[model samples]
Target: MNKNNQKSKDGNWQISFSPIFRYVAVFCLLIFATIMLGGAVLSFSQMKSNAQVLLSNVHAQTSQRIDESITLLESLASLPEFYDPNVPPIEKVKKLDQMSPYFDYLMICYVDSNITVYSDGSEPASLASRDYMQRLFSTGQRQVTDSFAAGADGVTLNYTVAVPLLDAQNNITGCLFCAIYFDEVVDILKQSAATSGYEATLIGSQGQIMSSTAGLPYGEPLMKELQNARVIGTTPDKLQEQLLAAEPGDYWSLQNGSLVYTAYQRVEDTGWDLLCSVDFRTAFLGILPSLLLVAALAALLCLGLSFLLRRYIAGQMHSVDLLVESVEKLEKKLYQDERPENVDFNEIIRLTSDGLSDALTGLVTRSVFLNQAETQLQKINPEYTSALCFVDMDNLKSINDTYGHYGGDVALKNVGYIFREYEKKYDGLVSRYGGDEFVMLLINLDDEAELRSVLEELVLRLHSEIGSAGQQINVQCSVGVSLCQPGMKLEKMIADADEALYFVKQNGKGYYKIHQN
Candidate 1:
């Protein structure tokens, strides 16, 4: 209040406002510093939280896949080869061989030989020498193993899911086995990381990276092979200890000179850890410009700058507010992953049928069948075989003439309905090739007897009278069947099947015949 100064040249009273300006400037600088530093801390906190959630998601998904794999193997073990009393050994080999694209290496091991079955053909070998086969014989229940270098594609890490194929006397006749490459899993983890800005890795029991999108190179032991793993928290030995522990946790470490915050959870039922890391430097980079602006404002305050600096500082603070708001928006979007990574993996059925589903029949189209079946044939593993059936509806024109279009539609729909039922029952792919014509592709059929019986049953069902649009119409179909030979083109197989069906049509209207070639 004390105006102990003289008047300025104009008319205004001028006092030294330096001391008060310094105090007010310092206060403003403190507020600016708080905004900058506090936001960095908050950002890091959000990042760590997000990392934890993401890692948990990755772990849950992996565990679910493992469980699903085991359940599938268990169901497969109950099939004719494994459990049915009267199923002959050769027939068992046939049954086991028909597993589709899913069974990378399917086998039924007897005391004498190991029979490998695939969609292409079968191979008889001494499979008892294989480590996985031996392991399944010992474990008895469903088991999964990793990095087992027993695959044909040289030496790459793969996850093997297996179950003991047993006899009715509860004795192990052999084992049913399949392998999934770890790369498939890595792709899934990468999807999660891309959405949430996290790095993921799967560490084995001995601390080796079984699968990884971060940290030491995959296949190398994490503890011994860690390149430039600088310490961020505890000593190197303790860091190794904590990481190797099969528990859920969060920790800090430095990799390649950048400090990183890490969270990890163990994959249930395996010696694998699902780890996620958030880089401290990257996560907190948003605070740098604000801090620099605040430091400049503090310097201006020291110089006793007034109106210009005040206006500039206000604008900078507003920009900082906008930046903070943007980051918060980002954090929200990253955490909620729709179904939080409800991943429905696309598995195109390699059927010799069409791709697009017929709206009326709700089955695949003809073109889809051919393209996929070709792919399936190309990937044929020895001991695997496929069957192709060409079904020609008899007297469809007559049905159309008698009942008009609606009645004909009913007859066609009935054929599709029966085909779909068999498709689901035998795990085959069937399609509506055209009006009143249907194509059925049966992969991994070990026994022609079973396939014949199924076709015979389906024909009977097709012949059943359907009351539609106030009419009873019997659907008779001519069937042609062809078994795929090794190195056989799907186009050739389809032709043979069509020819066989032509024979059936020429001979009698409603009977099925196997191509005698």
Candidate 2:
């Protein structure tokens, strides 16, 4: 019922909960995202390393096989029967039969002659037409060649290792040749890739596909396929450029919405590239289940944390909620002598007392100013001169039209800011009444000259500083001042100021006027 009792009741309500919890949650989410990104990076690196090691092993195994085949051909050349010109033709042919079980096929061709010998006991084919045999005869040297051979059955693709035979006088005698089926070598490349789920290819020196477990047609120019394919994360043109410069290493690209990790090794002995690749989704099959489990656990943790945080926040504000309910009961009784029971909070009442301050300008709201101003005025001496001023911004609408409503808000805030300065200097109350409007009450003006001086200083300071709020509009205001009288209700006093403000609007704006009545 009394002012002091009302103040005591207000003090019982305590406010809690800092506003920074939202920012804390956002920061935690950022940390989680960073961790997931790092995990993904490490996963890809490990998979790529596995691919590189597998490809290198395939290169080593293939190279070793080639060396063994060359050694076999050189040992076969040591036998004397084929090189000795004194031996009978039937016996030398029998020596060729002795070479059986060593090579898949064997041939002996005399130097500067088309006569040929075979260990298979099949009909002899002329070796003069074969490019590889011609080279052996003319150069009298050892050679390896990959080409189609004309056999009695038909032309067959073959890989051959050949050696020259020399007479005792160091003159050319004949040549020794051993052959392996091309399909047999293809089986070797396929065996290396069998269990790994990787597709393998043998790329020729001419950029063609000699053999492939990928089902590409043999002898097709592989560069045409690389150039025409659409590779993800890059245009087709750029992908072709990269493929041309691709070397013996590992690389990544996307195919069919899945990442592919490819590894290649150059077979220096054969002038070829051995390509092997595995898909990322298939390679990481064991890891995805684990990653999903981790992601699910993280989601549960976040949800549990959110639930506990909300309960904690509610518990902190329990006293404030009760105080609000008590205020509602007090309002219904029409200022009764009975007071509500007080809660036991100390500093929270002070924290909430000024919560109604304007967010933009730090001035109090109209209701807060009116409630506190009456009490402030009660202590003022009637003999001392005082004034209440109402202020309305002049260029707000134009500012909004020119630079949008944000600029209009900046203009109103500029005017409120000036009122705040006057409030601090002259020890009065300033409140943002509504949009583009503010009210000021100076308790002890001393004289009209002091009021006039303060108003002039506010106008000059506002004009100089308002445009710096970063909007491209000039700021100005119109004001009306009403002198307070003894026993004047605040409502009547404010109305008097409003009437003066209306008169300023009627005439030229951008200036202040006093109440005539």
Candidate 3:
């Protein structure tokens, strides 16, 4: 046969075995495969990075919340009422409850070398109070006790704040101690998890989960995992060593063989940690299904185009374009649009806001006020003058006992309002320094006479208001005013004002005392 006839016969055979469309089909299949692979890898990397960032933020935020909670407790301990032996234990409890809404339970203990009293009521008959007291006295610092199963409450942990309560002679009378219920902490963690897309657990130094969201078991396996997790190296040296040495953050496959991303950090100042983990499958839930559909459709289109005319291939390509557009829209809505209800991301936003606000309020508590006052005095020029007024509610306990806590709250709120009003008038800062005690900052008040007059009139107004509320209420406040001088420390002014207040509290309830230079 001639060469032309041979070529025609070969073409017929080739067409019989596989159509020209088959070649096009194979090429399209390869292209779809490549696209799918690239998309999957990119999605995986993005999801992992996002998960890590979320966990990192959760860790930092949890640490801050813990610190703020601890600081609030410490401030409560520093109050003069805690040192006053005459104050009943129940009164102190009520006062603490009033001051801190976050505290679910609080206890004051005097575990001294000689005497011990558990101010939460009474010591358990089965437990040896003396032994615990000895251990506390020896430690001489704040510490968190191990988690133990308390009856009916399941498992509970105790965070103890231990400080020395000094006497007038400057001798340590005993260790002023408080116990925070771990359940409240756990509730906070769960609430955080519910509102912030990440799961959170408070890990102790011993690898025990001191608190965790509801339904998470506090078992050995979980504890071991937390202990082994990878941690941020920027943590304190000891913590860094613990985290690096531990196996907690290591990769683990679930029962069905899914991988998860994990992260953890040590809480600064507190010997606690936060651990967070999320499965990648759940992290990018909807993205995978859509990607699979696109790949499948591409495969089918390639198969059809091989058997049909070129016009069909063009139609298939248009369909592919529409599919791509749909996927893009889904991605944008899922990742970039406003968060949806019951979605993981919304929780994070809410929790972050709550945590930050709580932290700010914690800083504004008594210690920060005192520090700011000291800083202001330190930077004062010779010509500038300031007045410090220590305002004390005369009988907060009696009022609370007589009218209940709500009334006490109302009275305190009124007092805060009054301070705010005066603050506006004097261009000063008024802080609820402690329960039933407030500090007013009056700047550039050089006239001692004018300052005295202002304080007296304020006290008279308070008395008149209290009298109208109820003659029996007779709520009164005593004011102690001290003028800040050049080269004087803020504490000296505070001490002078405190002494003057003490004199008034002794001599008369509703009176003002001004300390002389």
Candidate 4:
């Protein structure tokens, strides 16, 4: 071939490959650009979604905690001795202290006729004869009052809840008052903030900061913003509305020049609002480098694809695969990890495994236990008889008050161990119902004699175990058993058992009673 023809042929080859090269180059650039953009979008969306989910979880957990705490308080309030009018103030204070660990703080103030503060600690001078307390009592409604109360050496914010305690005659007795000191509540807020990766604060119904995790000073700008912001009341519908109405996502700078991404939710039953926020730059800044690196790498890859198409595709596919695998593992860890045996249903299993389990004792929580019991009742075969026993630790609070909460915890754990031991023999499920209360579900307890024998043995074993513990504690429990029958409601069975338990308590301590047929 002539030299000119050879050159022309080579030129044609280059020209033909140019379009393909350009197309490949452009496509690679587009892919890289799309990935970088998509990642940024995904990361932002994930953060937002995660924040929402975390807020939802926080709302649920805190609400549950509050509910549990309140339930404990209500139970204490319902005790005949609490309103006996014969129990001395000092004894009542001691009883309140025994249950104090369940709450951040507690007070048993009287708001009728005069505001007398029967605080667990030193009385706050500013709170003495407070009008808010008077107004709340007269209104016959629960109130959460926020104010600055003078403490021992200084003043601190107070979040006070006033619940009307009713007597057996259905008349309101002195109010059952409880307050959480701002400092202690701040600790809770800080923990929530750390867990959710957000700054958090608890606001009162009037938009006052009852407690704040953020160390930033509360000033005019901050207060103004809080006041102007839409407030969410402690209700499910209101919380949902507040979350939905939140700016799809936005950044706002405080007067002090710190930017934040904030969201709010109302804690149900507590009348307290949870404010979740994170420093905007802190939350988003970490992603910038990866974003930039991806853009840079895309540019380089597009430029180099002219020489190495096969290698590029292989690398991209490998990277994508790894990403997919990582995500799958995360999902597995987050939602599908194996739970312990004996947890029959998925929800119960999840609740048991989750940190929602009580830290004091390795027993199923009240919520989980009740839910599991209900589930078992639903699935129970008519032929397989079961009994629900409600156990109450008599003088448990007295033991705790005398020996301290740590000692109380030890006693409760020992009791749990005894129940577990008894449970083994009877094929029963044992759970710490709450504080000093426990529940045992014994399967196949149809024979009356066998059921009575089990109860007697359980009581004997419990006493023996307590005697061996060598502590200066006198432990006793009251048990009420209700046999599960065909077409019986679980709630009614529990109620019957509870009634029998109360009867045992009234008749004599350290005794067991079965509900009359």
TM-score of each: 0.48, 0.50, 0.42, 0.44
Candidate 1: tens digits of C-alpha lDDT, residues 100-152: 34444333223222424322243554566666566656766555676657546
Q: Candidate 3: lDDT of 448?
A: 60
lDDT of 4 by residue, 279-396 (tens): 5454555566877787788777776765586566556766766665675565455335542222223342343476545555556777877777777677555655578999998888
Model 2: per-residue Cα lDDT at residue 264: 77
Model 4 lDDT, full chain set: 0.62
Candidate 3 local lDDT, 130-182, one digit each (tens): 43345545554554444444433545456654555555665655554456665
Give residue 290's lDDT in candidate 1 (0 to 100): 61
Q: Which stretches of candidate 2 lie over 4 Å from their true place?
A: 1-51, 85-115, 147-157, 166-172, 194-196, 230-265, 277-294, 307-517
Ranking by lDDT: 1, 2, 4, 3
Point out the higher-scoring one by lDDT: 2 or 3. Answer: 2
Cα displacement (Å) at residue 375, model 4: 86
Error of 3 at 495 (Å): 99
lDDT of 3: 0.59
Q: Which regions of candidate 4 deviate over 4 angstroms?
A: 1-33, 101-113, 119-128, 213-216, 219-223, 226-262, 278-283, 286-304, 309-517
Q: What is the C-alpha lDDT profile of model 2 across 352-390, one tens digit per residue? A: 455687665557888898998788777666767778888
Most lDDT-accurate candidate: 1
Score each candidate by Cα lDDT: 0.68, 0.66, 0.59, 0.62
The TM-score obtained by model 4 is 0.44
RMSD, every candidate, angstroms: 46.7, 16.9, 47.6, 44.1
Q: Which regions of candidate 3 deviate over 4 angstroms? A: 1-32, 43-48, 100-136, 149-172, 175-181, 187-201, 210-241, 244-256, 284-286, 289-309, 312-517
